[model samples]
Target chain A: MSTSQDFPTRKSSWKRFDVTVLYVFDLLGTFAFAVSGAIAAVRKKMDLYGILVLATVTAVGGGTIRDVLVGRVPPFIFRDITYFFVSITAGLLVFFFHKYVERRFKLLLIMDAIGLGTFTVIGISVGLKFDIGYFGAVFLGVMTATAGGMMRDVLQGEVPLVLQREIYASACIAGGLIFVCLDILNIVPDINVFISAAAVIAIRMISITKNWNLPKPKI
Target chain B: MSTSQDFPTRKSSWKRFDVTVLYVFDLLGTFAFAVSGAIAAVRKKMDLYGILVLATVTAVGGGTIRDVLVGRVPPFIFRDITYFFVSITAGLLVFFFHKYVERRFKLLLIMDAIGLGTFTVIGISVGLKFDIGYFGAVFLGVMTATAGGMMRDVLQGEVPLVLQREIYASACIAGGLIFVCLDILNIVPDINVFISAAAVIAIRMISITKNWNLPKPKI
Candidate 1:
């Protein structure tokens, strides 16, 4: 139920541009994540309510966990109703348009990577604000990027991509390390976040293109 | 690292008795849940670190989630560290003595029920303190009782048992409603907690004995 006026298109400062770009990525990622979760519920033959619940959790679960761990309770998603609306809307769209959406799985994957990158940056920034140390910041970033999808997959009775055969969490970790290094070099916070997000996105895209994966442990 | 003298046995008021009993149940549940988690990790052939992580999460995930939702972050587990130690100890014990532990699944189930009841009471009490209202209290109670097991199941690559079978969350809800009813009838807080916890335990035990379960969707 957002009005067109809610779009802040006129703010064109370098800092403001970075904020808008990240916000757009966040929204896109949330929407894609919700769609994937909804699709998952559909496959599981869950009811409408289940679809909504899955979608909402997949969209916000990672950030919620990150916030909770860092003691930022009554999480940001609770304060900002838009995330809820976005998730619900995405679920509904998927429910009504499954055939069309199902074919776009590849596109959804790309969007999920973008969301991962953006969430990683956001989580690390929050961790830095709490002064939880460099390692803690990176851990939080990885949590924010992957925990939601992990929960979604678990709820759907599947191994999480990050835990199985994917470079998802590693991308977040790499991005987080870059963010820390940039901060140490006195980079502006906004620009640091932008570069980190870009790094995550690039790494994720390359991994997908190359079919990169973490080595499975020998049992 | 607990001393036997840390167990208070001198105070014998009804409230004191309730506290001690619940404390015992809490520890029992934590230990049992950790063992169950360790067992699951073992079944999955998780590494030692994975076993410890799974055990710790299964013991504390539910309560941590409840605390976070109720704005009680920097969760008690983080502050106490005992929960961490308890989970780790349980995991190590299971790793070393799994064959002996494997045959004790029945005992573990009984302890899990007790832990569920205790955690449910603790969550509702915290919710009440936050003025989250009757419904919020009940919701938190259920979350605290079930979220750990759900996380454990998810991490083990399965759909959460609470969402699928038995009277697990339903029992929590029933007990929470009883807690509120008792509050309305002016029952003492400690007594309310004790009675509510007993109700949850009873319901869970009966459900298992009778093979009771919520209806699955026909679709």
Candidate 2:
């Protein structure tokens, strides 16, 4: 529920650093997500166009939905063509070098965790800009972190992994809750973003390493 | 691309009729789509909450996406809670009377066709209200008509029927094209809506009866 007026009036170098770091992480996440999507498409034996489409959707789908919900027209990717190009580059790289990429699956998972964390914070920040309440902001944050992969799974003809069994969305939700609490405490915005994102990354990485899972219902 | 200026200045009774008919059909489509979604969820052995969620998503997902694409805030369903009620009603009915409903599958198909046509024209009309080009308008039209079903299928862990083997989206595309052409001819808005929607319904009905399908790629 914090607004722009809640923050300190003075601008600081830390703010600039926060912006740069967020932007870098966003792009990194986009690339990692796109590569994962492209690899899935390749496994499905999709054509080049299908691979690109899946890559782009996986990389930017969640943010696009987030933007639209906030009444931002043209979405972020449409405004910044860089995301599109980055997804395309990732798709192409995976298409040509998928064997090497698959061999480095652990690296991909690490990058994905980073992406998830960054996207969660980004979505929360964007949602806070609007009049949507804290719950909506947190929901958008989890959605931004997981919706792209959910979509990628759906497109590949499977139930979304987050829905089936994963600690993935839980990490985003936990991070989002932390972000809201920090903001309510009037923590510095730059510090808040970094801390919240790091929390998400840490949780996701630990879950992955431990092979933690959400309990499944008996049929 | 036709704007408000291109339409006749006279506010005829036909205009009122058009508005009423369009609104009614829109609700009809929402209800039918929701029922379809609920049935799918039931088949998947999902619980009541899952059925409701699927029903609401299938009913409103397409229009929500369309509204977002056109920069409309809160989406049409949020602004008019009638759609939400309609979807919920449909879901509950399906949950209770699925056996009877399944027996009338032909009737469901007919209702679905009506929904597809109504949604297509509505989406195009909304798009034209904005500055997006004709192509974008038509694209939105198809997305509005089909995206819900696509999402429903994806959530059920299946490739979308439209992408796989149906002649569904093609019918919407054809209807959208017809709407644009008729609009360009400066036809009366009321007549244009009717003709375009009828065209979609007719194409869909014929395709169903004739067992028409889009070509599938050989793996």
Candidate 3:
């Protein structure tokens, strides 16, 4: 079968596959966030330009903030431009077919959960590439997962759900911590990514199904 | 009087004086923004930590974003740390004596006007150092003047005043455009700064006194 001779080529191909998967997940996450943002803008009765602005910001805002903090100039979206197009496409789709999209609320939540997990891992990976410590990496992860939603709420003149009583950011934090711990233990990078992302997705899904929430201050 | 020989020395000393005055104005602006943020946080019944966070963000957020966009790593505040101390001091004072500060609201508004003008000119100067062009410079100028207040308002779960009917951002835009025009005419840098800042302060003050507002959408 020539298994020994093909080992190096197979390993390289596997690496490429892993990268491709991460990239796909990142785009999916952007689309989901953009859709949510467009929905919010529509609910606010904002004009078409406003809807597009909100969607683009909600999709790329967190990552942009993360990149700026980690000293990445111009941000990744500025360079690639695909994220901008994806967000615009999502916004337009929702603007035209909002009722249909709203009918699939359950599906949207699932997609959002997937996005949160993927974004957290991506943020942590980026942070770890810098001199920021593990704590900073985890912070970047949680910020990447939640900041976009916060920006959306803030733009709409509402307190952020994450700051109020959502289990959303907590799930991201847990997943980020797990990723860091596994990385510290010298786990395989690919396996570590899968396990951490899965953990976040699981936590988020369970919380949604169980109607879980973080405790609110009794002011 | 040896006027010819003294001309070069006077010019150099005048340059130093201009820089020092700008630095002082920057600090004053930071202090003013921090006090405003602290006031907002108190109104929202946020805790001490929340007050501190809001104050710091209000004072530095615009400058930090500007630095990041211009590819400055770690940001100027991180390196100097003076801005941090200035914000903390302002926050602490407001937390303790907010009633007194509130009573002197007119003085606060004047200080804020000065800050708006200074920040706008500073942002434009920074942007001009990059390859982002004249329009980008003006945009950065307006952004630097208004973004901190926007952040403050957003954190308090309110629509940003700059984005509302306020004439605040318009004043900044005018000041920025004036700065660009004067620079293009080869006006002296010091005189350009003074004229641009005066234009902003005048526009803001006149608007306040006349209770001016931008027209609202009739939707």
> Which candidate leads the pack in lDDT?
2
Could you tell me which residue pairs clash in candidate 1?
A: none
Please say which candidate is ahead in TM-score: 1 or 3.
Answer: 1
Q: Would candidate 1 be rated incorrect, acceptable, medium or high by CAPRI criteria? A: incorrect
Q: Rank the candidates by lDDT, best first.
A: 2, 1, 3
For candidate 2, what is the DockQ-based docking class? incorrect
lDDT score at residue B117, model 3, on the 0-100 scale: 88
Q: For each candidate in the order shown, give its overall lDDT on alpha carbons.
A: 0.78, 0.80, 0.78
Q: Estimate each model's TM-score.
A: 0.60, 0.61, 0.59
Per-residue lDDT tens digits for candidate 3, residues B54-127, read: 99888888888777777866677777778899889988998899899888899889888888988888887776
**Stretches of candidate 1 exceeding 4 Å from the true structure:** A1-39, A45-56, A59-72, A76-150, A157-219, B1-13, B71-73
Clashing pairs in 2: none
Compose the digit string of candidate 1's lDDT tens values, residues A1-219: 111222223234575666677778888888988888888877887655557657877888888888777766556664566787899899887777777888997898899888988888888877777889989989988888788888788798877767878788999999999999998998877778779989999999999999999998789
- lDDT by residue for model 2 (B178-202), tens: 9999989988667887899999999
Looking at model 2 chain A, report the run of 10 residues with the lowest lDDT sum.
A1-10
Using lDDT as the yardstick, the better of models 1 and 2 is 2
Question: Per-residue CA lDDT of candidate 1, range B170-217, in tens?
Answer: 888899999999999978777787899899999999999999876433
Please list all clashing residue pairs in model 3, or write none if there are none.
none
TM-score pick, better of 1 and 2: 2
